[model samples]
Target: MRTRFRARPRKWGPLRGLLAAAAVGVLVFPAGASAVSAAPLAEQDLGSRLAADYEAAFLTQYNKIKDPANGYFRQFGDLLVPYHSVETLIVEAPDHGHETTSEAFSYYLWLEATYGQITGNWEPFNKAWRSMETYIIPAQKDQPTNSGYNPAKPATYAAEHGDPSGYPSRLDSGVSVGQDPIANELSSTYGTNNIYGMHWLLDVDNVYGYGFCGDGSKNAPAYINTFQRGEQESVWETVTHPSCETFKFGGKNGFLDLFTGDSSYSKQWRYTNAPDADARAVQVAYWAKTWADKQGKGSQISSAVANAAKMGDYLRYSMYDKYFKKIGNCTSPSCPAGSGKNSAHYLLGWYYSWGGADASAQYPWAFRIGSSAPHQGYQNPLAAWALANDPQLKPKSATGATDWATSLNRQLEFLQWLQSAEGGIAGGASNSWGGSYGTPPANSPKFYGMAYDYQPVWHDPPSNRWFGFQTWGMERVAQYYYVTKDSRAKSILDKWVPWAINNTTVGTGGSFAIPADLQWSGQPNNWTGNPSTNTNLHVSVLNKNNDVGIAASLAKTLLYYAAGSGNTQARTTGEKLLDALLGNTDSKGIAVPETRADYNRFDDTYSQGGLYVPNGWTGKMANGDTINSSSTFLSIRSFYKQDPDWSKVQSYLNGGAVPTFTYHRFWSQAEIATAFAVHAELF
Candidate 1:
């Protein structure tokens, strides 16, 4: 009975919410109904263009200094500005002439590090790192075909050709929530090659100090040999696949390789001139090292040892030699639909679960990487963390142990074929990349009530459709109910944590690289599926709506990591939705900042100041800036795990005080390891 996902659930039939406010009311939205005003070159002309690029941005420590719009304004406008608002609401009314070189380089790096960590003034972090190096431009031509580093658009380049049912390419390519021509073909096919070159070395080590912004004491191996010559020319000419071996092409290894000869990457995801899954560098290391590193735990143990050597050969040759390939004396089923053990549990669960990385080199029960699975309804928390770490993944089976029990019994039958009749887990819209990849209608739908809200395995998605498939199925079932406590995953985490805190548009107004999946076209997750049009994304199913609650902030960070961490009722329900997120500038001498930008329109001071470095602690601290999607970095790590308890590891072992976007790897390693694996299954 591999049928597994039978379906039927949909409920929220108009006006009703508070099962937890659809996963804890929008984590980032300071003011809505589209406020309006300010037309730019103003607001003190962006602090006078950061006082004219403040001495090459104090040479780099203050960070930004040379981008100029080709690099999407310092990664979505200066590191997604003190929590994004499209520079005081993109010219009013439903957002006029929208702005985003990545939200104007995150609003010039929060106006020079929120006025240089509060009036100490590195001259507004050296003029907001030179107004985030005027959105860093360069590749307007040079390498012609595709050499990498490509971020140009602030002329708002609106061509808009995308909705051929290929689900959501920013709402089928009507394309212009301000710049996303498939991120310039994902920076010329996965950033000039070197496939995910550590996500363009985390925007050249957070705007030039070095790569993936690490090795920094202000990095120097001559800056890792001048950024490994753009990471070996983006891994030998634009990720055509030159890690040398290990499957060719890029993304889904460009249509499953029989190895059709000579490669520059391109095996599965797509490339015979590229068709669907635009594969925006299939999340180059989640946004390369979880939002430009330097937040704590020693760069989280050097980003979990280079994410265990980039998923250590897909947990040893795609789940221990392709799930024993038919089993001993074997010779068959190598790639065919096994899809290299579910693409190594979907890129090691978005890079070791947001780089807090649960180690042993991520191999969560590796049943040939959740083989023949994907119809959608959930099961890819990076292949259930390598099939729940199948005893311990690796190739030790020639003897001396480690056969991984028939691929961990198909990894608990692919997580009970991605459950749904209401018990939760709905990411099953399977297209394993080849032909007819079925199963994903929010994993099947019809689960008895909620008017059968199945719709989310991708119908229309250029941004936040299917809430990135229910935030990738509640981040692979809240990291499998925090590492297998499994009381039926704590009774579907108690009815999917109030159906994702009362029903969905995700934490309210925090989305940027949006795409939640659920559109055949009528459109209305509060409507802005902005893929260029009067809109078109719906795939059918319908009912519940709660303004698309970040798919209920993944059950409000899995009931605040099952109520163990900082839990005073999920930090007074995340400081009462961060105090109903009004129009920015709350200016209490700005410090405890966070953002959730939707602003294509809305003004009258929609908050600007920055310096949000929280977690285990670092300096000035920040959080807001919510939309590079995946439900705006998982609700900015579930709004800093609220903080009623573990006072960030008891104020960093006592010395106390911390939060410049503090120690977070998805709220410090997968939300306190799912709060010690669902601490005694509450709910």
Candidate 2:
């Protein structure tokens, strides 16, 4: 059953001192707002190790989210190198669904972002580039615009085969990432892992991330200095995109977008997938606006941004005519506040600048607390960061650069809510283990949105106030405190530290636990899933996780907190967690999960393993296979940034590509702004 640390699952015989090791001192803390820690170890240095285990788990295991074809990437079919691809990975995964390349790519980016933060370098993040090279070959295309070591194709399908002009995304099968071992565990064929449910993985970098590292890893190839597009297949040269001249646009035909492939040969392919007229318009408008903003001759911002704005206007118009129009905070059967298409409404609010420049728009846009299931209490860092850093305008004008205080407060509120005064949190706040894994009242409709809980059912629905009822609260909670030193942040700081200190034994901190960890608090119904048999295969692949979410993220927070204190004990703990994450994901001898090769799942991984390794089983895909990896292992990024000892992180950065993480900074600023920026930046 899902147990809360604050309440400690009552039957667990009082989890006393289970987190005492994380506490700075021994003192029972009170509830909410104004606070004081009796054992506040204000002067300590933990490092990026806080989230180490969880980080490693995310990177390696997340790759299994894809259903493998013939147990290898189409290109890497026969080229499976022992230590690189096959050595560390379990080959057998239950295939129940298709794997989406886009989703895998997004997950890859997520890991790179965090890894880059630890070392402040971008080279270690080259795994995404390599994936593209082996999979989509974006650089091999003749259309120069889409060049580089990036996943450009999600796999093409016949447009007329029972598919619509745009609705057949389901039929599209994307082949990316590596094999899934979960299916083997479940005795299913590799074909069970579908490759179609991964369409939304496209252009996610544009929406959220840009480059391999925080600076712009998505579209910008900062990690690799030499681009073939800029110089035409010359590894030593920079790649460039198509400047003009395109035969694909307008006209009611099934034309496709052209892109550069990564292979040495110049290539070209027609993306026959149904065109998203609206999404395409947005892309075009963005380009036009950007071009128009460029001075001196080649200014195409008007065509790009303006066009995008125009398209946005059209979409907005459609929205306004339909499920929009704000009224007084009225709750009704018809006017559901956060009902139909929540993201769509969010966009509308952004265009209106939060209600024609009013409080309603600003609040939800930046920091409206999520009071429902899935997302409860925690504010969207995106809104907060945008408010504090928007070039267009700050969410709050008066506060401006001086600071975004409210955002900071909200962060503190959420962070505090995530922690248990005794230590850790309701279930531990690692990023890998978010609040969704909690117990709901007996016979509830949902437990963190899933149909069934993993453990035995719970007795009550999670109230999840503030941070809400979370399964992995302590994991990410500590990082929240370390990033922003809120007045009450220490309480959280103390709570997660002890957990890390006690859990790690140098090489042990990782996404390693049991299949039961699937629904961290436990699935609503006791889950008996395996790596390959379950519908989603990721959980099985990254089965033996590093628990890096909290440990790695917390390590860095601990280090920064302990920096000047010169605390040797804290330093040792930080270093231990750091090494643990590396052991968990650094397959290439580098402290980065971007090294896909060195991180193969293990033999037993056929049973289930962490970072997709050790679960160990490689089987072939048969007819009608549908299962795929469940949880993503791309979260090791938090490990690098959360440890006290960044030696390996530094070593990796000194050499390869790694993406920088912008979440903390972005979120911290937003929280600060929400609490204080609106008053100043609004005008």
Candidate 3:
């Protein structure tokens, strides 16, 4: 997802006052680690000048990021959970900055992995995983009824609508769904039916009062969710609810009636996993293993590596259809149900979800994969390769490694199929049109019988509109090419890198601009052994801005491509962009001021991108805010007005000019650190 935001600058809340205690050395230890310090930067002399400079840069950013005084993380008892941003007033993919995501946790892993590479200390990397396992991944106690899941009857069918107005979509049990191919195998291998993957979202501070398993105990890091309606449901238009619904808040059935039309609602727990974030965790673990092995400290990170492998095992759920319907050309509900692996698409879809009734209930649990494999941004060939080829990372399940091996090649081919004539990759393909196996427009481009969609999953601002997806996806491709010297990957980057470089500008005094919003025309040709380029398929840079996170990510992609291909221009551009980034460094981390014109949309109604509660349907948030047919985004979320930055947005809502703010997002800061570390390690 794009790390864009809208807000005016505001000071952070109270700092933790622990910075001075951990500032004694160059290496910053995580909270709960030993109080000892490493050697001073002046004393440790790396032989190479480039190594020393980049290492120092990495350390500078790393210290600010991990400093409790900066507020990037909150230490709950012994666990450290990273926030989406240091500022609580922010809204992007998450409604509040304090809310954490699996994406943030993955970047946390990357930050510590780079630290281990630079300082020969692997404990921090291991510690990060331990924290992720404890807080984000739902525990057995959290998912108490998984033992009742039935592979034969995975889930009843529910047609997804296009917008919030079309929600509470009726569940139709008349449609036939396929059997789950991997559930039995996974349960047998792990000796448990519980899922091991991390849930995508968490209310880290329990800001919404969705306490532990919906018991309302004020527990921090509670499971919560938003964006269940449809593609038209943007962050501003979502109604937040507890993942474990217990009628503690909202209407008679909690928030269930708002999204699904069921005869009766059950008190249950559910979770949605973002596949990209989980793949990214495995990708970082691979790098940690590679770097530690070179230092003879591989054993220090062996446990974390094995856990990453296990996560990959469960992550395979993303490769199947939502109801496990047979893939390709199924335009009606009468389409044949898949028997085994026929439903497997072998590509990473948007999400995979699971849920079940409360512990005392006797109903069976349900699981579902996704049908839309949108943006190439989600693919992680390197992670797939590691799971299939690396002995330490190969999954324990009998067919897990084999499944990932197939996914690796299929993912690469997908990249080749979607690459445009102008070099940028186009949007992805969907098996179920309109999210219900509906018919597509005549002559629609196809990939393995799935129709191409320029904006696949979400559609409010359009999923493929942001250029960050280009950089994010290509970075993985560049890494794959760098590691394997695979000519296929190089060919794809050969076209994409120059197109990106042509659009990017890095200048003096940290003034730089990279493609921000993108506009696309036409579509890629249908897939073939030798897929022909659709000359009609094209992409244009609609706008540009200096998003520090995207710039750092772009630099990583370019540097990796340059190191592998030995291209002089790519190396020069990457180095220049990275040098430009250091000019913007601040006390918290590197950042640039952003004008959040979109903040005006905060109070918008359904017609204007705000919350749309159905008519005559009434509910109440835990804070007792009334939810009704006329509720605006701000109406139910009265908490936003309590934010310190609310005045700026309030003034803007009152017809003032848009407010501007410099955001210190956790993932961006970690990316800045890792960019420097990668440069030091490679060159």
lDDT of 1 by residue, 401-500 (tens): 1223333333334333333333334332212211112122332221111111223222221212244345434544554555455454444445545544
Q: What TM-scores do the predictions have?
A: 0.24, 0.32, 0.94
Number of the top TM-score candidate: 3
For residues 260-287, what per-residue lDDT tens digits would candidate 2 score against the true structure? 2121211122111111222222322222
Q: What is the C-alpha RMSD of each candidate to the true structure, in Å?
A: 24.2, 21.3, 4.5
Off by over 4 Å in 1: 1-419, 427-498, 501-579, 583-585, 588-651, 654-683
Report residue 121 deviation for candidate 2 (angstroms).
Answer: 7.8
Q: Could you give candidate 3's per-residue lDDT for residues 179-205 as a string of tens digits? A: 998999999998999998988889998
Q: Which ten residues in a row have the lowest lDDT in candidate 2?
A: 349-358
TM-score of 3: 0.94
Candidates 2 and 3 compared: the better one by TM-score is: 3
Per-prediction backbone clash count = 188, 249, 0
